[model samples]
Target: MGTVRRRLAGRALSGSLALLGVLLVVPSLYSPTREMAVADREHGSLLSHQWEWSWGRVRVAGLEGVELRDQWNPFGLAVLVVLLVSGLAGVCVWLARRVTWGHVLGLVTVGLLTGRVLTTVAERLGRSLGEVDQGAAGLTVRTEMTQAGSLETVAACVLVVALVLMGVAAARSTGRSTLPAKLPGTPAAGTAAAGPPAGRAGPAGLRPVGEHLTTAPVSFDDAGAGGGGGGADTPATAGKPGRTP
Candidate 1:
């Protein structure tokens, strides 16, 4: 039950990351235009300036038409790449279910794709700390990060974090039933089974069980009977060898 839950959680997180990348790509694809601010014109009326942000282009418009334009749209290409990466990763994540290598592969794909997206947005589109307004040559200009660009940057960060965490979760939940690895020729658990056979040559170089004995432990009476008589001149009658005279 626990394993199933963990697998589901990991898959959900991976899918969410992919979806986030796609969401970031959506706004970049559309490239919406909005009014930045209204400035004073030569007449008694006010003039509105438009800020156009889209994939592959950005432009500033005044009363007449496009006054300034910048074609340096690195964010668009970056987001598109992230989109594709997210899709590929999502597929890998689903297909490789319960496989450690698959999870790792999906994470790697996401890592490669989203890693650059954040940097691209920060370097190209997200410049101002907040909104900035400046006046030059009787024209007022407002500079700020677009909503879509901000979202893209945020989504990239989230995707990276999600992939890292997913890897961790998978690791923790793995090998629940597997036993600890042991070296070759290791004995099984139990004192009797692990010990050496009785009394030949014990473990750790211990001596055998009765190595000092040269004869059987026999009584003097039994020895006399086996000798055919209880004679006084018998070897047993001479008493034990270690006795005092």
Candidate 2:
């Protein structure tokens, strides 16, 4: 009963975790920019040249703007990053269950740092394109846009829930036996090499007994003795002898 209860609890936990993951995973894909792009494309509209960002000249007279601003979703980005990092962590934990929470945290931290670096690089590249020459003013606008927190917040919330679920799932899956079975000191089951405990003989070790016991000599010894038996009252004659031979 206890075993069954534990299994049921674990299953429930895993199910909840998976549900959270689904919720979070979806938000990462929810980029408002896609809708904005579709809208722009559908209308065959172009960005107003006067309206620009940190880089400036957002649109040419005849050229269409890519609506990069509309695509900006801080919450979505956060969720996406969290989902990706957690997924990678989960896979690593699954493949090598020895991984600790610190390991997973480190991975997430590094991933976030790398993402920041990339975002900075992108921002720099955007500036180089003369799209955001307004400098501080443009940066403020971009910051505000990123912080608007609507769709992006929802995505982030989902992502956070998913991450929590993944963490719980991973925790439940961790144990000594969860590690790769090939590790040293771990037994390789169902093979002859699986011997007995150290310093002890196993079943196969007793085969020597069968081979050695069969070679016992039953013949009488004392070949050097001569004229020792004094007829039927001899010292060696104790049991009844047939025909007194």
Candidate 3:
């Protein structure tokens, strides 16, 4: 029972941390500023010059300026998708209540890798948006991590810690099951190995108290010598006269 409680406690903490990381990822990962390129002008695409990504959504043009004032969640997208991928994985961990999901992690990482293929498309469209730059783009794209709670690295760290804790708890639980059947010097369970106390009957067969006699022993030698038992006497005197003594 104690071990169970401890495991549960550890899992609960891990789930909570994973949830927190996911929540953080819901906010803006990066804010991007883009200048109209010659090709864009020639093509008349008129895409939004500013935007940011969060909650698995995208904004462009007029939509881009909506939350621009929000210091922490400046609008951005692209490499910051790492936050989204990590966030999704964290959610899975929390839901499963487990930390040993290496497969899940690998799958998510592969997904992120595939998504990187879109980098070229984004860069061409002035999608300088990313997790690292954090808006060094001519002060035009600025973000504050404090208020928005979009510190990607910190959030990821918290999730990692949660995973570690859950794994440790699982390891301990497994160890308990693999322990020796019976420890040295420890009495075995059940009455199979138990024995009766001194003078007590054990494995008895027939007779009320087994096959023991209740009477005391007698000395046959003394009885034969006429020292401890009565017997016939003076037979010799009758046959050959008295000895006169």
Candidate 4:
């Protein structure tokens, strides 16, 4: 019963993590911390800018439309891959009701994804605060990550913890399932210490020969007396009938 409960809990956690990851992927996770206004020296106009990070793309918007759009950094790409792989592994584990390689894969995926997101956020925030960009006509602009990115980072951390717990639960369930069960009325460990030693006598009432032996009394004396009496009678009859001899 305990094992069954653990398995059910593991499945529930895996499914929940997988669903959360899928939902997070759908929404825009990254948004600019602050709007940038750059002065156009030639036109004397102020241009607005915004930035967003997606799966493998970094999008920058200008006053009119998209200004600079490109692929994400290698670290960001790796994070995206981890996120995708972990989500898939979680789903598979829940559906198959087995751990196997999925546990290790999910653990690695969550760790990498969470670590990358945290590092990236920290680096971006530090750079945005410490450095300044000097554009045309000495126009200075700085940007930092917003709450959306931070929230996503926090979610990634939570997902990693959830995956770890899921792995633990699955491992426990697997162990319980694989262990041998004791039969009814079977003695537990060290309980047979009082039993007989090997090659010793068994229980009472059982014999190797299987049956008891018996003997009958003899009558040698009676046989001898009857023989002597018969001999004497024969001799007396011969004496009485010897007159003709």
Top lDDT model: 1
Candidate 2's TM-score reads 0.27
RMSD to true structure for each model, in Å = 9.4, 13.5, 12.1, 10.5
Expressed as tens digits, the lDDT of each residue in 1-245 for candidate 4 is 87587678776776577457545543433443233445565565556565556444455556676476544566755656667666666566664656567655555665555565556556556656775566645565656555666566556666666667767766776687687798778888786766886558667887744345332333334543366665433322212333331
Better model by TM-score, 2 or 4? Answer: 4
Which 10 consecutive positions of candidate 3 have the poorest summed lDDT?
32-41
Quality of model 2 by C-alpha lDDT: 0.40
> Taking the tens digit of each residue's C-alpha lDDT, what string does model 1 give over 1-245?
98678667776775566656656646655554233555653442335554545445555555665475555577766666565666566545644576657666666666665665656566555444454543454655555556776666676777677667666655664554264676567765795375665655567777566776545554565555565655455534344568542
Give one digit per residue, the lDDT tens place, for model 3 in 109-152. 43343243234233433433452331233223332233333344
Cα TM-score of candidate 1: 0.52
- Per-prediction TM-score to the true structure, in the order listed: 0.52, 0.27, 0.41, 0.55
**TM-score winner:** 4
**Model 3 / residue 223 / CA error / Å:** 12
Task: Compute the lDDT for candidate 4.
Answer: 0.58
What is the lDDT, from 0 to 100, of the residue 87 in candidate 2? 53
In angstroms, how far off is 136's CA in candidate 2? Answer: 26
Q: Which window of 10 residues has the lowest lDDT sum in candidate 2?
A: 30-39
Worst 10 residues of 4 by lDDT: 234-243
